[model samples]
Target: MKLDLTDRQNQVLQCVIDAKQQKKRPYTKGVVSRMQEKGFQITERQCAYDLSVLARTKGTGIIGMRWGGGRTLWIYDEGCIQEGAA
Candidate 1:
């Protein structure tokens, strides 16, 4: 399904993308910290909120934390999925 992301959600998504690019890692905890380091005035909860949205919406190219169970869990970027699909 197509999904429209808010500005904040997009920012959060971009942050995750950049972080992954630099660290070669994708995960929730790092995303939360990265958001803060980048001066995004949001809490981990808020980050998780956007993540949940990205995860649920098919084709968004993001995979959010499912079950809220692991710090090692990550946000995935699917090169195969384009913005048009999202």
Candidate 2:
């Protein structure tokens, strides 16, 4: 998708991508903490909002699902779907 993300949103997306690449769960809290550790000021609430927006936005290739009895949220790319049918 042609993402029209703000600079901050792009950074948030990068954090999610990094976690996916590392086979780690891209939870809201985790992403926020990772960004903060890297000196990228972000809050858990804001991260959660970003994830929700990204997932709900069309053609973003980002997908978010709730697990752990709907208490846990994980974000990842819908890579295969975005690649289209072979």
Candidate 3:
């Protein structure tokens, strides 16, 4: 499904996907902090909201907090189209 997100939302989701692909846990707060460090200017609450949308939105196939020892992390499901997929 197409996610009707703003450009900044897309960027944050892309970052989460990249981090997961690299075998790093994409925790909401951590990702937000990293993005801010890189000058993205996103807040933790915003990240949480986006992540919740990803998890709850149908056809997005974005998984949340799976098997990470209780840490709030997220990853896109394998069948979901990635941010940059053709």
Q: How well does each candidate superpose onto the true structure, as a TM-score?
A: 0.71, 0.78, 0.71
lDDT string for model 1 (1-86, tens) is 44588988888778767866776566666777877787878877887788878767677677654455656455557662665443
Model 1 has a clash total of 1
Of 1 and 2, the candidate ranking higher by lDDT? 2
How large is the C-alpha RMSD of every model relative to the true structure?
A: 3.4, 3.2, 4.4
- Pitting candidate 2 against candidate 3, the one with the higher lDDT is 2
lDDT of 3 at 59: 58
Better of 1 and 2 by TM-score: 2
> Where does candidate 1 stray beyond 4 Å?
1-3, 65-68, 80-86
Arranged by lDDT, best first: 2, 3, 1
Every candidate's lDDT: 0.70, 0.74, 0.73
Q: Candidate 1 overall Cα lDDT vs. reference? A: 0.70
Q: Largest lDDT belongs to which candidate?
A: 2
**Between which residue pairs do clashes occur in model 1?**
27-74
Question: Which residue runs does candidate 3 get wrong by more than 4 Å?
Answer: 66-70, 81-86
